[model samples]
Target: MTSLVVVGSGIAGLTTALRAASLGAEVTVVAKAALEDTATAWAQGGIAAVTFPDDSVEDHVRDTLAASAGLGDAAAAGIVAAGGAEVIAELISHGVVFDTDSSGRFVRGLEAAHSYPRVIHAGGDATGLEIQRALSAAARAHDGIVVREHEMAADVVLDGGRARGIRLLRGGVLHADAVVLATGGAGALFAHTTNPSVATGDGLAMALRAGAAVADLEFVQFHPTVLHAPGAFLVSEAVRGEGALLVDETGHRFVLDVHPDGELAPRDVVARAIADAMAEGRQVFLDATSLRGGTAENAAFLASRFPTIDRAVRAAGIDWSAQRVPVTPAAHYLMGGVVTDLDGRTSIPGLFAAGETARTGLHGANRLASNSLLEGAVFGSRVGAAATSAPRSRGRVGPDAAGPGPLPRQAPPRADLPFSRRALQRLLWDHAGLRRDAIGLTRAAATVASWRASRPAQVADAAAAEDDNLLLVAEHLLAAAHARRGSVGAHVRSDDPFTSGKTAPLPEATLIGAPC
Candidate 1:
């Protein structure tokens, strides 16, 4: 029987374990915290898929490519887009109950850059929580899968140039025929992120150390609407789909001046617009007060459709139904990581990755809103089945095999300031955050390198290990951002001379409201 080690227990990790177990493989899932603590659970926008009759796979693929800024792999986009229906059905089989209207039709929503209303949610804005609950329950019920919680995966155990298992931070090793990394993204690398505390780029750092090739580390997606209050609560784009608008302190809809889609523009465009506004000493706000004509019916509708967000907003002492909520852009997702093929095979044999940990090229430069959940479902199953049948020996097959050459290695310089996770986050936020230029990236790279030089050889605890991983990933991210001189997708080089005249005018259109 095949033995597999699945790291991280979000939708991707759990889905992988369940699929592998059904295929007669014994699986062990390792999680940094409790099984429920994951970026997936924090997701509010629901998964993207072609469910309605008006939506087609071709249209979905086209929207994905357009949002990617022509850098996305068409084949990859087609694969995920075509697989959406099947995966959505599979999620239903796993007991995920999506929201439906009074007539029992799925409640579909429209997000920025999507041509159709295909995003489906459950529990209103608690979509991720529902998915996580159902999948976690399913995994717990499976006899062939073992759950190991409160355990951090420190490294990938490699042997003979192939992945053998995982090294746990608390101690001991779990050996397996194949190892799958579904450990989420590096959102914690930034000071303000919607990801939970455990998203420290541990999987990416482990892959890098294991000699795997990673790509597109420069394209980090910053969400345009995180509540500017404490905790950085994410205000889902679905709210905008429901007719909310973004406005400056002077009551101007500034995003409309940047793009004709206004609040419905691509995430990177809206995020950078918000950043530019803040840079000019203007605060941004999401004005949902006029949603549904701002009547009592509107308040009830908002509370019903976005319970999670409503509660969070009310807890912050703001009635979003009546007032504009202060918002800012924050690191939301990473579109790059250990590069993998459609089957989830990384450069290293016996090493596979899925979900946010793998750069499957489905999301090119910028990720279409709500595609993250679909990627987890579609590719997580693929990785599970692939890992179950992976051969003991195989040639390099990832980015290193077919793409550009490997990234240049840089030696760490002498230490300067004392290293702290907060300081690292702030540095990345300032230099590598929403908008970056050559000088800021160069300075950020040197500072990160200096901190890497002072890292302890032995990680004392989980926190220390996270700090080390953050530093390593930060260095790589800075390097990638510095190397890419042009602005594209989520990676904006403010000083790029070639960026002028790149953007054409978008056709004006009315903001889309949620499907009735």
Candidate 2:
């Protein structure tokens, strides 16, 4: 039995374990897959840390608040920007080598938001992998840390009114005085995503089941430049920062003609512009050929940035250096998650959350460029330090005092469930893509609801999971989409494109049969 168990081995989880172990606390990390396969590994853009000489904390803070669309917590955004440089320096100390120009100065790339170049990357676009490799290596080597790869955390065990430990399958029970949930995001619920398959809202679902308060479920960020093809591999927005244009089927540069900011506008604007162009029977392209400093060398940079996307494009009989890669919007980030304070403490004592799974209001309606990774590092370390100092339980948990036992199993995997997930994905794309109407949303919601109601009864009781976990996640997302009514961020409403509430808050989940 471990003293502290952390779920998800991405940057958030790795940082959490590292900080705690550094403070002399025993830590155990449980992951569903190899440490390298988490969503953090798939991030193509660099981490947006304010490191440039001209950059100011206020400017960075303002950019984040602007992207959040107004409901963003001002205080939290400030805290995030304040710690930007320190965290970057900390990563450097940990041997996370970021990319630099030939002169050895940090090579900065621009993404949506900020008034200047303030992004720090690793090897051009493999920031996620670089950071993960360093942190994972450090965590595994720590004497106080124990990593259990392939062991998935079923749920957070709750006893009385506090978090006690986490239960798993490979290992019967791992008792802990405290548990840190750094589970990634719910990006996998959507068919077209920049996230990995393991990001199935496990942290969000598990935290909610453990009675943690979550927020901003309604705000989802869809990266506007994913390559629109068979697999829809994402081409990084860094391509735009490096001088690419969004053009229409007529080969006319369109974004410049529509919005003043053109291709450089925020993600919401670009995604909508592309959708509108598609609605008018036009396909959009990133016109990189005509820009200054645009050449095969630029494509070489892109190829280096995302090897997976590059290889896939090559297989599709296209040379990106000389040709335009087709583009579309795919679900990318969840701006909200389990609610937490600056230190990452959840509503429940002894439980901490960080990363995309915890909606700390840092990214309000929409997250700025690379702040997602920075948030995972900045607050992730703070939370880990806080958890390390948490007072240990005076007495061991007795059998009668142990938490929500063995935890609850997610609905098991099944073949038909994949079909249901795809169906829901299509429905969401059709109705809730860049725009939405009450009629389509209601229809989609009702269909998903009917499926949920008909799912096996065993799922209602955690006794033995029935059906598949994917279906449950789909049901909840559809339900929440139906509950929200506004055109804020990515949760746009066609029936009411105008804002509804002054600050439209996301609805609290209403589980049909939660195992209390």
Candidate 3:
């Protein structure tokens, strides 16, 4: 019997494991932390899909391409748009319940760049939690799937240009027919991000060392309205979708002057606008005071529709119904990763990637809001099916496998880290954050490279290994940012004047870390 190993427990990894197991393949899911610790469960804005009569797949595709700003792959976006309803049906069949109106209709919410109200939510802002709850329970109940938590996948074992399995950080290996990487994104590299602590780009570093081609590494998206407070809790874009306005200090609506859509403009536009304002020492606020309509009815509706956000803001001593909440741009998502096809096959055979770890081109220069969860469910199922079908991959026992080949070189002896995780994060946020310039990026790259050159030859412990991986990812991001001199979409270069709609020719997706 064929076996598959999946490294993650997010929507993508869980979905892939469950689907592959149902397709008669024994599956093993290894998560670096608890299953619930994934970014998926922490997602606030709901999944985007076309579930109504007024919304068409073309509409969804058009919106995605618009947000992508000529960098999106039409074919890949088409596949995701066409698969949304089917995946929604699949999620429902698996006991995932979405929020609905009193008339028993799926509650659709509006978000930035979306033409229609097609975003579906559950438990209001707790949509991700609800989906994760249902999927986690289902995976545990499935007999063909085995889940191992608290196990980190250190690297992908490659033999003769094909995937053999994964090597764990603690020193065990799981040889399998195929390996799937759903290890999320590198948001934790930034100092102020809404992502959890585990998102250190582990999968991307592992794939690069294993000879996978990664693309568009510089197109990191910054959330336009992360609450500017202690926890930096994300104020969902859905709040802006529901009549919130972006205002600077002294109640000046600055975004409307930047774009016609104002607060509803694409995320990249809104993020830069906020960043520029913050750079001027001006505070930005998301004011939804107008939504209350000065009555109990509006207040109850706001509380019911966004219970999680309402509770959070209330705890922070601010009520959205009557006050404006301070916010700032923070590192949020990566629109690039290990390059993959529509079915999630990477450059190397027997190796696949899903979720935030895979760059399937659906999100080109920027990602459409809420489309990530949709991608996770749709492409996860596709990859699971493709991995188990027809011809089973076998290991090649030749001189090629014996040679060092493209596998990661041995590290120098473990030495003390020159910078703490917090300090590294500040370096990333200051240099490679929302806005980039040639000078800052070059300086940051040199500093990181020097640190890498000074490290011990061999990895001393898991913490050292993690730091090494983060540095590798940061190097890739800085190099890509430096290469793309002109700004486009989420990659806003302060030195370049290129802006959206009037952009220069969209450059080819930056592919890196390929075997020579």
Q: Spell out the clash pairs found in candidate 1.
A: none
Model 2, span 137-201: residue lDDT tens: 88777899988887777667776767777767444667787888887987766768888878778
Off by over 4 Å in 1: 392-412, 500-516
Question: Candidate 3 lDDT (Cα, whole model)?
Answer: 0.85
lDDT tens readout by residue for model 3, 5-87: 99998999999998999999989999888877899998988999888998999999999999997899999899999999999
Show the lowest summed lDDT stretch of 10 residues, model 1: 507-516
Which runs in model 3 stand beyond 4 Å of their true positions?
Answer: 295-298, 390-417, 499-516
lDDT of 1 by residue, 1-516 (tens): 888999999988998999999999989999989999999999999999998888999999999999998888899899889889998899999999999989999999999999999999989999999999999999999999999999998878776677878877787777788999999999999999999999999999888877788888889999999999999999999999998999998999999998999999999999999999999999899999987764687789899999999999999999888889999999999999999999899999999999999999988889999999998988899889999997643432232221111223346556576788999999999999988887887778777877776666778999998998888788778767776767888988879835522432111221011100
CA RMSD, predictions in order = 7.7, 4.2, 3.8
Instruction: Score each candidate by Cα lDDT.
Output: 0.87, 0.74, 0.85
Give me candidate 2's TM-score against the actual structure. Answer: 0.89
- In Å, residue 471's CA in model 1 sits off its true spot by 0.5
Order of candidate numbers by lDDT, starting with the best: 1, 3, 2
